[model samples]
Target: MLNAITITQIYVPDQDQALDFYVGKLGFEVTNDMQFGPMRWLTVALPGQPDRALLLEKPGPPSMSEETAAQVRELITKGAAGGHLFFRCDDAYKTHAELKAKGVEITEEPVDQPYGIDFGLRDPFGNHIRIAQMKLG
Candidate 1:
């Protein structure tokens, strides 16, 4: 039986730059950094959550055709392909400020919603990220 999600992948144009953004800016810790044949197994995890990880993948061969890969690259560039990551934080406003100060491209300011106080930002490759603090009821 599947107990939990171990890894989820997000494609990027460059792994090194993604690594820098995730590790240097977002403060994700590097879990794995090894080469696996043609692909580099680069994964990052939020601090204290070592079991779950995000795989920073490059858009290229072995899985998709060249044409499809090209289209994916275009979509990612336009911020349409890569899906979003939602994170639960202690304080959404504070987190947003920290990320903004770190030069993260915040697309939305923190606002109260049905769920919580939330804000949005984008990774260098245009992947959307949401940080939220749930309302206690």
Candidate 2:
């Protein structure tokens, strides 16, 4: 039976740069970093959440042909690959300030919503990300 999600993947043109952005800028921790023949299996997780990891995949061999990989890469660069991630934070405004001070791109300022306060940002690879602080009932 289905239980929990283990991992989610997003394609990047360069693994090292993605690693730096996710870990260095966003404070994610490396869950795995190893090689599988020509492929590098790299994964990361939020500081205390190791049960689920985000795979920083490269668009290349072992998955698709070079021609297809090139097309994927092009789409990713244009931010049309449909990659997105949503995150919950303890404090939306604070998190936004912290990330902005770290030089992370701030695509939107925090705004109050029916659910909570939320904001958006884009990863270096053009993947859209939204972070929010929710109110408890």
Candidate 3:
């Protein structure tokens, strides 16, 4: 990043369920889960990759204006996001194949970029997740 990878926020219906899926299934670690009034701030980070954290929270917070929250909720409901939030993979090709074989909803096939190789997968919650491997220089 231009500075550093912080938390990539994701809105979820249930934070506990999200933790079960991302943490229990995908092997992410629970970094932060705390409450401040009616809202809770939850974050998860990968073990091997900890530079960034994933924020799991529901819609609505004093931080966001009602109009902005409404727009974000609309985007989340429509399932049309700007781009994907990627997950690093050791072998992008094989991982993509295995995921496809397991009936995971894949958005795109592997594409080789100048800096890396990656493929996109859609989570159950409509979050586009990219799995990439760095291309050798």
What TM-score, computed on C-alpha atoms, does each candidate reach? 0.95, 0.97, 0.74
Task: Evaluate all candidate structures by whole-model CA lDDT and list the values in order.
Answer: 0.90, 0.94, 0.76
By lDDT, rank the candidates, best first.
2, 1, 3
Candidate 2, superposed: residue stretches over 4 Å from native: none
Report per-prediction Cα RMSD to one decimal.
Answer: 1.1, 0.8, 3.2
lDDT of 3 by residue, 36-105 (tens): 7878988989996666888887777766766877777677656774435777788988888777675577
Q: TM-score for candidate 1, please give it.
A: 0.95
Q: Residue 57 deviation, candidate 2, in Å?
A: 0.2
lDDT tens digits by residue: candidate 1, 69-120: 8989889889899568888999888888889899999999999999889998
Error of 2 at 137 (Å): 1.5
Tens-place lDDT digits, model 2, residues 1-137: 99999999999989999999999999999999999888999999998899999999999999988999999989988889988999999999889999999999999899999999999998998888999999888
**Model 2, poorest ten-residue lDDT window?**
73-82
lDDT of 2: 0.94
Looking at model 1, the pairs that clash are: none
How far out, in Å, is residue 131 in model 2? 0.4
